[model samples]
Target chain A: MRVIFNEEMRAVADDLDTMAQDVRRAINLSCTALLKSDVEAAQSVIDGDSAIDNLESSILDQCVKLLAKQNPVATDLRVVVSTMRLASTFERMGDLARHLAEAARRTYPQSAITPDAMPLFTQMGDFLTVMADRMVSMLADRDAKTAEQIILSDDQLDALHHKTFDLVLADDWTGSRQDLINVVLLARFMERLGDHAVSAARRVVYIVSGFDPTKEPSRDEGTDID
Target chain B: MRVIFNEEMRAVADDLDTMAQDVRRAINLSCTALLKSDVEAAQSVIDGDSAIDNLESSILDQCVKLLAKQNPVATDLRVVVSTMRLASTFERMGDLARHLAEAARRTYPQSAITPDAMPLFTQMGDFLTVMADRMVSMLADRDAKTAEQIILSDDQLDALHHKTFDLVLADDWTGSRQDLINVVLLARFMERLGDHAVSAARRVVYIVSGFDPTKEPSRDEGTDID
Candidate 1:
């Protein structure tokens, strides 16, 4: 029974890895769509979000089944519960990517990002892609250090988000009201994507160190312009 | 042993009820702050958010302890897992309230809602307060019908969110760029608050009916502007 439990746990971990990979692809594709106004890439991200959501549901069902059958306790139980949370976090990350894709699709033939803010958004996209990759590595290795690094990286994303806001609100910004609205929402979506990645990394740290990092105040709180 | 498990489960339920009540109050207070530009009310909401976070942590700890100690299975196990999700959802609802409060605080002595958008924001605030109350009732009763109603109500909130965007982006909009940003974020925050409520309601439905409503496409998805 113990052997079976361990194998099922491994299967669950494998599924989480797969979910993270899908999210990474979605983020990259969505960034491409947003930066280049590629409607096809945007459509692909939108169409692919359901697969990420399905993975989350499947991971959750597996965790519940494991609890029912194997009855894991202590650290084993924490792993299962943490996996459930990671699935949800990754699912949200996928949705953020899709939001970006939808933004791109909405402005097809004209990029949502203005010329002045393009560099800032490109930096944000690069940060998100790297962060997504690190999340996958952290989950696989279960290294608390990697998880902590991911948390720190989110601060940089927040800075970039604020910079985007400043750029849009500047006197020189020539975009229309619609353009300003789109830029603000897009920046927020990217910021939130980083926040969700930080959340997933924190769960991994908790699972490995048996310490609840969430007990600390969340950095993402009260940071939004609103 | 069974009696002890039952008693512990009851304690968990009671804690959830308390959390819901706290969220309800926070929503009302934050709305008062937003609508009236009451700095004190905003501060109260911001100050009280930590308590809500603490409650969520305590509830999560209790759920984890129950899982480890009692090794609940089948329906009992589902209850524990579902409770964890509910705690997280309620915590997010609290954060949304705090976000609204923060928005109010940032614009103290100057209201975040423009004169023209006052009625819309007031209606949004009322809808949120009502939804929070319904969540409390649905949790206590485990009534799937109330949960479904909450889900439907979120659609109305979504419509209001879009309307706010239209108002901000209209050619006649005279607010400064900063005003536009503030109004859009505030509206999105309120819309997201409703979305979180729907999520909590869906979890209740899942716990009661053993049917996963989340399997269906989430209505909140793809609705946001960019």
Candidate 2:
């Protein structure tokens, strides 16, 4: 029974890893779609989201079945349960990627990004791509240090996101309202993509440290617009 | 053993009920703070979110303990697990309320919603309050039909949110870029709060109907700028 349970847990991990890979691909495609005005790529990302959602549900079922059949306790339960929590974060990450794609699709032949903001957005996309890679690594390592570093990368993403605002809000800004709106919303979508990474990373931290930040920390993490 | 497990499930339900109530209060206060520029009220909502987060973690602990000890299966397993999913959605709802309050606190002395947009935001808040109330009821009744109505309310919230974009994006929109940013972001936060309610409500529907929308639905739920 112990051996079988271990194998089942491994299967769940593999599922999450696969989901992460899908999200990684989706973000890359979404960003390309955004930058290149590639409608097909954007549409692909949007359509692929449902498959990711299905995987998330299947992962949940695996967790429930393991609990029912194996009756795992203590540490094992923590492992299974934390993974379940991470599954939703993973799904949200996919949703963020899909949104990125939708932005591309909505703008159609024209890129969603304004020329002045393109450099910043490209940076944001690159940062997210790296962060997604790090997420898969962190999941494998479950090393709290790796997870913490991901948070630091998130800070960088936030910095880039903040930089966009000054441009959009400046008196010298000459973009149309629609352009400004696109910039505002896209910057936020990128920031939130980072935030979701942090949440997923934090869950890894929670599992590794065995201290639930939600309970243990009084740290005032101010709410982002994300 | 059966009776004991049932009682344990009841305790978990009661914890969630308390959470829903706390979240309801937070949303109302947050909205008040946003409209009235009530810094103190906004601050209260911000500070109060940790308690809500703590409750969420405790509820998870309770769910884990029951699963580990009772090894619940079949319909029993479904009930416990679905409620656990709803717990995160509940926690997110609280966080959204806190974010709403933070919007007020961040912009204190200056309202987040412009005078022209105040009526719309006020209505959004009222709708969310009603939805939260419905959530608590739906949780008690586990009524799929009530859950569906909650989604209908969310559709209305989406319409109100969509209505804001036109006003903000119109050629005549004269607000500063900063105000526009705030209005755009706030509208999203409110819309997402409604979406979270739908997720929670849908989880109830999933448990009752045995139909997992996460798995079955091909509906293109577009990505939020959130």
Candidate 3:
């Protein structure tokens, strides 16, 4: 009986890891759709959201079932609960990416952000995809060290985000002010995507260390940027 | 021992409810400060965020402790899990309100929105406060019916948002495009606030019913208004 129960629990964990991988793929696909203006790919990302949603619900249900039937304790309970929360955040990240793709689809004909602005936005997208991929790896491996590296990646993202903002504002007085504004807003949205991925990575670290890494540095404690 | 455990459980539940109430008040204070451009009030809201943050952490800790200690089953476990999840959403609402207030503070001496746009903007503010107030009440009372009402409030907000957008676009947006963009973006932020509040209410209903209330047909679902 014990061996069968253990096998079932292991299978459930493996399934959850696969769901996380699906989310990573969805994030990548959405980013591609955004950069390439592939409405079909963007539509697929939108369509695939229901699958991600269903996966989230299933993971939560399985975690609950495992806790109930197997009576997981200590590290096991933490791992299950952390995975549930991570799944929720990951699912939302997918939704946000799809939303961004939809925005790209709508703005395809008109140059909302001129081709000049594309490089920074593309960099932001790459950063987000890389961070998201690392998060998936950390979660699957319980890799505290890799999770720590992912946490550091957020600092680099912040610098690039500041540069993007400055570039947007520098060209704000140009003819297409509306386009400039849209570009800035879109850039901010991409930066937020990276932030959410970092948040997922933070959860992986917390799952192992039992402490929130981001809370370590007070967001405004020593910042005089304003 | 059973009696002692029951007493402890009741105490935790009461504390969790109080924390929710604190979150409610923090959101209201932040919203008022943002709409009124009241710097002092904004400062107060900023100060109040710590209390909300502390409340959320404590509530989550207690929930985890209970889960570990009691190994609750079925409804009892659900209640504890739901409380933690609801608190997470509530804390996010508080953060969003704080962001709005900060925007108000940053743009002071020259109001965030133009004078002509004030009426619609204030309408948005009023609707948002009502939505927040109703959400808090529903959470306190576990009133699913009232929670559903808050979801409908978003439609009215959307109408006002569209009106604001049209007004902005119809004007000869020539000079000070940056200012105009800020105003429009402020409106967008307010719209997002309404969305998040409705999301929180939906989560409340989910906690009570164990299903998503967002899937239910609201009157505004297919209203072709774009």
lDDT of each: 0.87, 0.83, 0.67
* Residue pair clashes in candidate 2: none
Best by DockQ: 1
* Runs of candidate 3 exceeding 4 Å displacement: A1-9, A109-112, A171-178, A212-226, B1-6, B173-175, B212-226
Greater DockQ among 2 and 3 belongs to 2
Clashes of each: 0, 0, 0
TM-score: model 2 vs. ground truth:
0.94
| Model 1 agreement with the true structure over A121-170: per-residue lDDT tens digits | 99998998888789889988998888898887778989989998889878
lDDT of 2 at A32: 88
Q: Could you give the CAPRI-style class of model 1?
A: medium
lDDT for position B141 in model 1: 91
Q: Residue by residue across B44-79, what tens digits does model 1's lDDT show?
A: 989998888998898999998888888888778878
Give residue A82's error in model 2 in angstroms. 1.7
Give the lDDT of residue A138 in candidate 3: 86
Better of 1 and 2 by TM-score: 1
Task: For candidate 2, give the lDDT of residue A159.
Answer: 85
Question: Which structure is stronger by lDDT: 1 or 3?
Answer: 1
Off by over 4 Å in 2: A216-223, B218-225
**How do the residues A1-226 of candidate 2 rate in per-residue lDDT, one tens digit apiece?**
9999999999998998888888888888988899889999999998898888888888988998998899998878888888888888888878878888888998898888888989999898889888888888898877788788887677788888888998898888899878888898888877877887887887888888776755647322332664
TM-score of every candidate relative to the true structure: 0.97, 0.94, 0.88
